[model samples]
Target: MKTAMLNKYFNTPHESGLGKTLYQFNGLLVLTFFILTFLVWGGTGYSAGIMLLLSPLALFVKDRPLQITKEHYLIILAFSLMFVAHASAIYRGNSAAEITDLDQPMRFILIIPIFLYLKKVGFNQTWFWLGIYLAGLICGWQSIAYTAGEYGTRVSGPFNPIIWGDIGLVFCLVIGVKIHHLIKNKPQTLIPKYIELSTAAISLIAASIGVILSGSRGAWLTVILLALLFLTIAFVTLPKRISLAFTSVMIICSVLAYAYIPTVNVRINQVINELSSFELTSSNRSSTGLRLQMWYTSIIAFQESPIIGLGKSGLTELEKRLVNEDKINNWVVTESSQQHSDLFDMLAKSGALGVLILIFFYYSTMKAGSALIPPYSSTIVMTTLAYIGFGLTNTIFIGMNGTMFFLVFTVFTIVAGEREVTSK
Candidate 1:
């Protein structure tokens, strides 16, 4: 009876009650962390996220900390390849300017405290799901607010629509899981079920609209892939009727978004045009053509130093080579140095070995996140899939938002969900 009472209301980090209060209140700390992570706008989220680590650090100091294991070291080593790839390039005289960019990814190490804290006390799924709901809600509103404006095709908040759309895609997966869970569990409470079911519906509709309005082709592609993945997983484990219904809903959602949303059609037209009339010469540099044109340089740079590639700062050499060959547009060369695609960027900066490390890291992340309950494992896999799809066309690691999203969630899964069930 005493133990039950204690477990209900108290979280004792140490034997004495002196530090129990702090540990008891750690849930609030975790709530704050999740809030910061989900609200990836401006620099505020990242800043607050880093500061929130103090709570866990304090608890870890007061309570018994986790012992470092070989698995943990290996995971860290996999992550190390990310930073080391850049350093190796710099070592090989890639670019001295990469220092500023290097610092951005280093902040991803904050995932350590985040993982440790959540691992000790488990994550607040209620709050986390709520954040996902709110994100979808906000992005949906933003889409409506931006529609009919000049930027209607790329409806967004502070960040680009691509980021907004990609995150919304992940939220859609969350929404899908929530809806599935509600139905799968056969909730008995009519009132609660209706309320939750309504919330889930609204979240899905809004996130779907947000994705369409954002006009992010990468996100659009991933949405289709994730939807198919969800359906396939369901088909294997769920009733045939349920799987068929899910498949129908996904198809309907895509069709409605494409047909009713003006931005979706616009993006499709742009893609069609870009592909149909792609020209690699300096005379024309379409969006698709520009990406291809830039890729020309990346391919050349990779071939030259296929081992590690051109190093971190190898862009200088690449641009110079582009000028000599005249294979790339002067406009693209002058406008941005980014290869745009993460695949090519990895090849250009780190070479084939870096790409292999990245592939292994992603595979390991999914491996660690496998076999957890609904929304946990599925969420990890689907979100990872979204990023992978997005990375094919964009530079995910070069930016702060993508880097944080990937590391924080990946670490959380490995330490908490994948390694063990939530510690009671």
Candidate 2:
């Protein structure tokens, strides 16, 4: 009787409990940390910095598991080296010239530690997935609203125009998979089933609409890639009946999307027309000509400094000179623009060393991803492949939201590999 009373007293909220208090606070800390991450990117330095500072709470909790793997080390090495490369730019006398330039590399010091700590805590995979989906939904809704009256044209929401659409599309793909899973396992109870179906249906429609309104050809290409990946995975892993049902659903969705969504139809037609009429040397074509010019300049910059390459300072100087000489328009000039391509940008900024590190990183990740089997492996592989495909045309590492998304996904991939090994 005394022991029972003691147990009840200890567990009570008013009690100065040890384990209970710690558990409750730890849960709160985790929730707050994720919320901060979602809101604190995109130049929110104070908020981001505070979140990073608070991340150590996860590390401080006793008995918290750490799940670092060889794959994690390789991925961390790649990003760390890139951060070092950016910091090296400071030595080139660029640090004092541009506040924005200094901010990115300086901020890296803070971000790296936060990610390290998060990994140390064995952060919940489900929370990470939920965060991705929620971020996507918010961004997609805003994007659709922004482009509604723009006459079949798409505009970025809060993100920069060039890659916002791509980010949104990737988010949609992730969410779509989650929704499919929910639908597949929906409860037999009518109320729960209706709730699940209605929510999934609404989100699916919203995401599709957002993709169409964005009018990003690159994103459209990515969507196609996603479809192919999904079909391949479903066919290989699912029962024949389930696979056929999914295929039918996808086809119906596609048909309905094209027939009922005006923005989608118009955007599809636009993509077709652009591809059919594309030219290698068309100064009048904004997208193609601008990308070519950026590539040309980036190559020239790389040629000049093949070893360490021109740091941020050199790129800035080149942009200024190009602008003065009318070699390129000012709108194409980014604050920290290199080649829009991730690989080429590495070459331009960190020279051969950066390229080699990135190559090693991606190869290691792909190897790790390939080792896993079935649904999880397929999901990670497809998502990683999509990022790679998108990275060919867009540099994601420097962008605020893109970089965070990349880091989060990379961590999850490593965790997934760890889980697979443990399960075996």
Candidate 3:
């Protein structure tokens, strides 16, 4: 019965209103995202993503009364909580700069309507993943250039490798889905298995190399952790032969990377050295040290006003505290002022309420795509987890790049999973 309703909602064509325009506009939004994601950089792409929200806005407000429904309520509620947090901060007289943080989660404002529209008309993962794949390929090309030039650290063309790593991780997941389909002989491709497999393999290899080349230890750790979890799941539930093959392939890849990739070796060694040299008291003065200092001060800020924390003012307060503690060197304050970690950024900036909304936002989004099936599910879930992991060591929600990537996928994922209860 439920499937029948879903079928009808999805299959029925728009005969009146701007439904057709709005529906087609959805595809255009994705196409724009793809084009911009691959070819563009800086604030422009993220800005365009935010601007793309206007298409749906016009649909809801311009042509007809906005259709509010139970189907959209989850997304609505999730987004509303984010707004409430931002609004609450502003109502109480927070810095206007604090509002910029809203761009992070606020990027998903159209999930509800977009999901409904997509459910009605359906979307093709083929096109979606293709966009993602092409974007990753661009990153791969730049990575080769970066390495060939002997550029130290990681390989990111224009953006931070952390952000680049985020892109690569999603592409690799897309490759996983594509490869699975190829293996299933899904008849989606006319190309021979060897050719298809080779392309997919190159893409995967390139994406993984790009991630490692970015030298984002955080991303590297997250990918490794995810791999272990996936392997365990495969071994426990998947066919024995398949599991064995996967395990063997993963082991080979890891071994080869660790042995052959100089950057990989350097990063691992750096992690070891950093951990070994870490000191809490008075700070150690390194990349890891900076994070520790920032984290400690953020905790202090959170403790000071657990209910309604310091907001951007916390940065000032943090500086004062660090100054008083004699930890306020030029560098320490420089990094701390930026709120390097998303955990503290949320805690210190919006306090506990911000954190709650954040939790709700991610939870709802992961489940938002609950209506999407199979490979689509994999993409959404992995992307969410990757962002969460990246957020741990970096201010993922603070940066435009990180937030923009998150926004694109969260909306995509929810729409893919959309299960709107339509007319009977």
Candidate 4:
């Protein structure tokens, strides 16, 4: 009887024919979604909407039986607690009407089921990496446009300024791996090989230019980290000869580029100056200083209501208080926004509980990812690390675009890695 039930669950029509086509189509759609996401929202709301829409389809088309692991249960429990805490805040009127206004919280709820379905379908590592490369290319083009002054002086691309930095940082990793892959391969045709190399080179150059043009000191630091990670991974994984050649080429190119490009030199120096001069206490220093103040304010708010805190719209209320106290600058403080730290924002809004859940969510995802490392594992590892690094400075996961990319790509990376192991 158990065997029969298992067969029934795995033997679904969706595994082939229309279902198979749909599955492949959805993969393509997922790729398109990532490209547009960076170009549109910079990784925020619209991206989440795309994932929400597909989650149900993924659920409906799934041929395999559902399997919930212990980690899955933990995540669900955490999310549920967050929901309950927010609901309590809403009931107590601790949150503003506007904070309770949108469907973001609801969307996160919907994401739970979708994420489960995606876990079942899994993904191919190659496809996942390809998607990242495509996203990098699109972002690269936008960066070039910004540098050419086709757009604003600042490199805003499709996403907001903050997200643009994150996108650029991720692209550096995506492009680096792709270039490495292209160089390693010797295609049958010279033309195709040349084309592949050219495309990879262009993409890398574009992303590099974009990173520089972004004027995001954090992002610049993030890209440098990404480059180092890439080199380290290659040194550890690849053959000695290949690693040496790749490292040599990279160093030579870097030296040549730096020696000739005055603009690049100027930008690097400017970033160094900004980083050196940055202060945590000075409100007048820059946004980083403001962020430090906000962090302090959030900690104080968290202490006031350590358990559940203020609610979903808690930050808005905190911002109002800060403004009234004249603690925040008039020119910078606004009616809608709060501090830039996502963790601190959660602490002020949802309290310690919410922050704990979020940290757990990221921790579990990373843990899952850690067990699935291999040929493609390094790429996933680097990309995920880059996302986390960027998140420290910017709120990349709260909005639909950011949330969608974060959840989808993260799940895809794990699924793909697992699939590879199982196949072996």
Of 2 and 3, the candidate ranking higher by TM-score: 3
Of 2 and 3, the candidate ahead on lDDT is 3
The true-versus-predicted C-alpha distance at residue 58 of model 4, in Å, is: 5.1
Compute the lDDT of residue 302 as modeled in candidate 4. Answer: 91
**Which candidate wins on lDDT?**
1
Q: Per-residue alpha-carbon lDDT of model 1 for 276-346, expressed as tens digits?
A: 88766655756777788767777888888887888656665676667667666676666444677888887
What would the per-residue lDDT of candidate 2 be over residues 1-424, giving only the tens digit for each residue? 6775445332222222332354344333434433443233352233334446666665554444556667656656666676787667545746466555656555445555655654544333434443454555555566656774445466635555446666566556666665665666645232355664565556556655566677666676676676777789888998989989988988898789788877678766755666566543433545555566667667877888888777767876876677677776664465346567777777777778777766765665566566553334545655666677676767776666666655545544454334421111
Candidate 1 has its poorest 10 consecutive residues by lDDT at 415-424
Query: Which sequence of candidate numbers ranks them by TM-score, best first?
Result: 1, 3, 4, 2
Candidate 4 residue-wise lDDT, 1-424, digit = tens:
6776444323323453544554455465556656675566544344445655666665555455455667567656655654554445454554336655434455546657656755655433334545666666777677667543322445756655456656666667666765676677654232356766676677666666666666565565565676677788988999889888877887887677567755456555655565577553344545555566667677767987787666645655665677677676442345235446667666766787767776776666656656664534555666667766666656555555555566556556655565321211
What residue pairs are clashing in model 1? 94-313, 95-313
Output the lDDT of residue 47, model 4: 41
- Candidate 1, residue 335: how far the Cα is off, in Å: 4.7
Flag regions of model 3 displaced more than 4 Å. 1-28, 43-71, 83-125, 148-153, 181-199, 232-255, 281-285, 327-330, 416-424
Task: List per-prediction Cα lDDT, in the order shown.
Answer: 0.66, 0.58, 0.64, 0.59
| Predictions: Cα RMSD each | 4.4, 6.7, 5.8, 7.5
For candidate 2, what is the total of clashing residue pairs? 0
